[model samples]
Target: MTKFNKTLLAAAVALASTQTFAAGFQLNSQSATGLGRAMAGDAIIADNASVLARNPAAMALFDEKALSIGATYADVNVEVTDAQFLGQDLGSIDNAAEGKFIPNAYYINPVNEQFAFGFAAFSNFGTGADLTPLTEVEGTISPVDLLGNTEVATINLNASMSYRINDALSLGLGIDLIQGSGKLSRGSLVEVEADGWAVGGIVGLAYEINENHRLGLSYRISPEMQASGDIMYLGTEFEDINIPLADIAQLAGYHQLTEKFAIHYTAQWSQWSSFDSITLENPSSPEQILKDYHWKDSWFLSLGATYDINDRWTVRAGIASDKGVVDEQSSLSIPDSDRIWYSAGFSYNFSEKSSIDFGYTLVVGEKVHVEEKNAILLPIDAYTESGANYFSIQYNYTF
Candidate 1:
């Protein structure tokens, strides 16, 4: 390999070393309309094949074949200011990252009244961050221009069984065969390395109350997802960082208020705390150990509604607040914070079995105060990160 490519590869490996080497973090995406409506009741909507990824029980609602394919574009604008290296101006920096296209697909099939199966691919988690021109260049700054990003992806094969317990209740159970991967990169001046694996499974359940109301839940067993890669800085091999992936939980429901309107809500919890820290195995003296992730558990709460405007048009809208897992000790890469969401969407029915769905979301990040001490030219603070914008479209078909 050429020197540039080798350097880039080392850089990539180093980048992956810093990120949680799971499948990459997921995009919190399920459906276009779900995005427009803040993902409320995504587990119970049972509107498309993607429902298999949320709550396996929702598959029971599909008595025929169904498929959903779509993507979301994310526009991220970040601003970092108040630079002070011993109280120097350092000049403020404002820039935006290239927008990302988040895409996913799902398919579901039903047999008789007691069984269903589906497959789905979606971003389970991921985050990206880049900082241009530090206060001081070279020796004065350990990291001159910081550019780092982490990605996680998952493909799940699922099977579900639904039983009609009675005239008023139906129950469902499901299993997920999950595959995941991760990639990392830093400092455009260097190469990027990516490594990760797919591992995770568990159970899911759902319940329907009458013909118009439903609830669903899902859980993934904690998996020791393995991330293996090489990290190189300035042409020197750094070390390898390995992380154990955490578990997930989801609960959601749908309630029809009238023939024309319905309301829904979702509550989800992630065991991020399980990621206490990562241990890097290296041969250097002292082994270059890093400590203190101290990540906390987080939650997401959302409320949304679907309105039938007419025979050909349906509308979705929602708002949500999702807590951050990062604490006061977040890294420079992903200056992550809690977020609030406002979203809206529409679905156009081309026919009873074919339709198009579109969604738009505005995310507002919470303002935060950060301070860096010790060696290196980090900073005493960075700006409150800006929220992101998401636009998505999906083509859905059922047979």
Candidate 2:
């Protein structure tokens, strides 16, 4: 590889470290029912075993053992327009990150009226994008460092226990065993891959004001994960680097106005401020900064309603505003911005013991502008338009 390419490659590697397109790389695809309602009142619904994934305290609302299995397909489209690299006009790259599938499962067992146990498995953060258009310089043979292809995936397993203290109050606790992995490749010259595990915990509380009103609160404490991986640059190896994940907290509520109508709301916060930078180091030297994230804390708010049409059919609708975490620092890897969500869904009860749910959501992001200079003296200026679509299906069985 050429010297100019090496410099550009370093910048690409740095930017790729923190470029997550989905609300700063945190996921809200835990349950299909939640997706139908734009994730409103996720912690208090307690309609199925999927509630174990959001708030274990909700398990106290169940009287029987139950299981839920679901999957979501996220189709994302990102476009870069009027891109200028070192003052050269380059048109655009469409569908930067196309389609990704996320799957989840949960189970709950109520041993008695006051005690319940449950478990859940799901994906918290994942992304994939291609930006090879920025790797080549216009009208020259020299290397220009733009973003390239990158992929990241994480899986979280949780086991929880809930105690019903009385008719109106419940408390829950759980532990998390998270596994994360990722890879970054820049023009075949620089490739780095790594995988590791991290431990975390969750605490939740739920209160029933009456038969028609309920409230819930939950907090997730996820510590930074230090991944031990090999970083290869131009055939040189740098082993033992660190990667970080953020923490989150949420408050949710559910209200039933009549026998056939109900509403839900949720307010969620993510601690993106904890993630300031990415560092990589070897056993022989001190740590080096890959990139500076400098992200700010963010919030998500949602409201939803459900209508019962008959004994077996129900419909749902909702809207939400999800804040972006980027703090004046946007890159070519993925343009991060605030998003608006519109969603709808339906459920059909096959019998008293089984049911099926389908949900869809549309996410539209505010236009974002980017202008940044890498160490190679190349400047990347571009405007990005981004959006996403989600389709999900879930099945619940009570025994």
Candidate 3:
């Protein structure tokens, strides 16, 4: 491949991996109730049908049919500042991240004394950013390989079943149908588009120590996604690409301390170390390594509390720490960093069978210095800061 072609190909790889909204492009906006408490104890809360998104075993806690629908608006803010190449100012980009809305729905039904089933629709990962405007800097050479528009989205449709074994233990299994799509462009130098589907699953266990204490654990198995579309490299087109996704494991606990108060916590892990690289393949040539992430595993920890104000009102608050996944290898397209979450929300009981929930959270990311190589293998330096505000609402009903 020519030097110019190699440069643009590297740029495409960086764009393909860019995900700035959440750590490594993983999303946590499944439900408003979970968001309010930073997802603490979400796997075992069993307060509503939304629990199906986490642990299906929690369905055993309900004796009646339940439904929940909700949506979250993520207002993301990302700024790339003081970008330079060998002392030459390449300018900066303000608000490169885009805003989006995430939606979810869930339903649960108890079939008999020992069986329950549920369905859920939600997103586990997504990202969107536009840095194309930075390529228009005047009186200076633009870093064409480092600036572009990128958008990626994934949705998970789940069907789960739970079996109650005695009164203290429950086991659950779920099947996931994941849909993914992406688009990347760099001012005509390169444009890649793809869409595909994959299958995965999750298993969970719920243990009830007493009427006021419970614990839940779950592990999600992710698939290697294979997508086909227009993938151009050095004027040659490849028919397919394979992207590896990370698995997830989490443990959660809930303790009702008093008649009107409760405490909950969660420890979650993302197996990002398995997401080592991206590969491009075609019938005419051998598989080629498009990019190597060299990312590390990450953890997210959260603690929360709920308080009852009255028969019709309840309030909750939470805090969380999210560790970054980027390791020795970094990219300007991915400004990954450690983050903190502060959240609050409330539920209003309209009656015994219906209610509404509202939650808000502020995510703050640490500013970090990033170093990357340009087309000619020259070092480029930049500073990046990312943050977001999440507002969510949901309607829930029980029958």
- Candidate 3 ranges with C-alpha deviation above 4 Å: 1-13, 16-19
Encode model 3's per-residue lDDT on 1-399: one tens digit a residue: 111111122234455324465677778879999999998999999899999999989999999999999999999998888888767787877888788899999999999989999999998877778876666777777667667787776678999999999899999999988776677776655578766566789999999999999999999987665666777754668876676767899999999999999999999999988778777788889998866778899999999999999989999999999998889887776679999999999999999999999999999999999888865788777898898999999999999
Top candidate by lDDT: 3
TM-score for each predicted model, relative to the true structure: 0.83, 0.92, 0.95
- Report lDDT per candidate: 0.64, 0.78, 0.83
Model 3 pairs whose backbones collide: none
> Per-residue alpha-carbon lDDT of model 2 for 1-399, expressed as tens digits?
101111122233355522444577777888889899998998998888988877889999999999999999988877777777656666677667768889999999999999999999998777767776655545633233446677777678899999999999999999978766666777656676665666788999999999899999999986654555556765567664454556789999999999999999999999978777766667788888766767789999999999999989989989999998878777655467899999999999999999999989998988888777665757677888777889999999999
Evaluate model 3: give its lDDT.
Answer: 0.83
- Higher lDDT: candidate 1 or 2? 2
Task: Provide the global lDDT of candidate 1 against the true structure.
Answer: 0.64
Query: Which of candidates 2 and 3 is the stronger one according to lDDT?
Result: 3
Residue 299 Cα positional deviation in candidate 2, in Å, after optimal superposition: 0.5
Model 1 Cα lDDT, one tens digit per residue, 146-171: 44454433445555555545554445
